[model samples]
Target: MQAAPPADRRRRRADLLTHIVLILGVLLFALPVWIVLMGSTHDGAAIGRGEVPLLPGAQGLDAYRRAWTEGAVGTTRVPVALMLWNSFVMAMLIALGKIAISLTSAYAVVFFRFPGRMLAFWAIFITLMLPVEVRIFPTFKVVSDLGMVNTYAGLIIPLIASATATLLFRQFFLTIPDEFVEAAKMDGAGPLRFFRDIVLPLSRTNMAALFVILFVYGWNQYLWPLLVTTSADVETIVIGIVKMIGTESNIDWSVVMATTVLALLPPIAVVVLMQRWFVQGLTDTEK
Candidate 1:
């Protein structure tokens, strides 16, 4: 048999060390989620009393059912299912809205050379420095003036104009070869037609990646929803989950954990489902 090379041995050692470190990291992150999952399966009294079981308990199904059908104790009266639906709708609207607006804005900036183009780009980009928190009062006044309070439009529209998304799309557009645009022009394609036929198709992966990110961001919004939605009908899961935690004496730990698990599932699923496209998009856009 041939002797193993020193380089091969060193490479193997490095691979083994990398695997060990990654495994440790995974366990570290997963530990809290595991505890939460286990806690959700147990009785509220057990969890509240600090008797956290390592294994799944007999109350798993019951806890999930209660959390789904009825809101957590001390939380909003809205059911978990309803809150989940509302969260889904809000997330989708925000993601789609951001992508639509960003794509068009970025395309115009990249393809058109109209007057004040750079000025417009800079104006939009400057918003990135000022987060929603800074302009909350003014934004709220605008929403209130528009009669959008407690409505889906109120929740989504204000948050949809994302400077980061616009920037990402702009960067990606700058990288597209001019040949494609020239070819489209040669084929008698108008701006809108070229955008629909060529640009959008090229942007598919980026859109998927952005969708995953924006969906999670929207789903996790707490302050904005709380500010805009006075009605329980439009309350998101994040807000609903917080409302679940009552005073120390009244808190139902098991139910709260269950609701947390419910809240986490959708974003997790979205990321998992779009993992391929998301990774590809990130890598491609960087070039």
Candidate 2:
């Protein structure tokens, strides 16, 4: 073969290095999941005794079955299925609620002329500083007074007002050409009609992006749900996993691994399924 150019050789080397690094990164993350998978098939006692098996054991798949049907090993106050259901419902509600509210709020802030409009937008933006953790006490108090405590409403409603979603939506709305607004007005379309027809269609991608984020946020919620719910009836899968581990002595290593694997499925499924929409929403130049 003829000698290649230096630039071509350098490019080839860089590509090789990049692939190697990417493979390493993938292995770095995948290794732990592999261990967890293998460990889930072994006895918790064996694992507790410091056996770190990197391959599946003869324990079969009963851990997953027990986790799905029962809450965990020897703990069945709430089933994994039920907890998964609660988390799914909570996540869907929070994602949809945030999208709906942020849509309307951003529309008003962007298109409608009103008193203190900038102030209103700023007020909403300022809330980004105050997350649920910061205002947990008063938030819990309000929920308590409203009797929403331990209810799905309490679980979802408090967390649905997303300042980040509102900000992103407002910025996207700004990209919309004034000609569209003018055209809508010329067509005798009112604000609501214009919003329904023009803004919403344009916002579908952004909404998808936000839904992926907000759903995961709702799914992974720990503190808020822990404080809000006192019953297993409203238990989230995350909480169920925590309870499964328990203290060091009573920890069911195999079952915990199994439950963790189960818990990971939903968020992974969501991200994998909506990855294209998520990426497009964030990158689409059409806004």
Best by TM-score: 2
lDDT of 2 by residue, 1-287 (tens): 99999999999999999999999999999999999999999998899898888988988798888788876654555878899999999999999999999999999999999899999999999988876668999999999999998899999998888888899999999999999999999999999999989999999888888899998998999999989998888999988877777655777888888888888899999999999999999899874
* lDDT for position 15 in model 1: 100
lDDT of 1 by residue, 128-245 (tens): 8886789999999999999999999999999899889999999889988999989999999999999999889889999999999999999999999999997889888888877788
Q: Residue 7 in model 1: shift from native, Å?
A: 3.5
Name the regions of candidate 2 deviating beyond 4 angstroms. Answer: 74-76
With a 3 Å backbone cut-off (N, CA, C), the pairs that clash in candidate 1 are none
Model 1, C-alpha of 154: deviation from truth (Å):
0.9
lDDT of each: 0.90, 0.89
- Superposition error at 166 for model 2 (Å): 0.5
Q: Among all windows of ten consecutive residues in candidate 1, which has the lowest summed lDDT?
A: 241-250
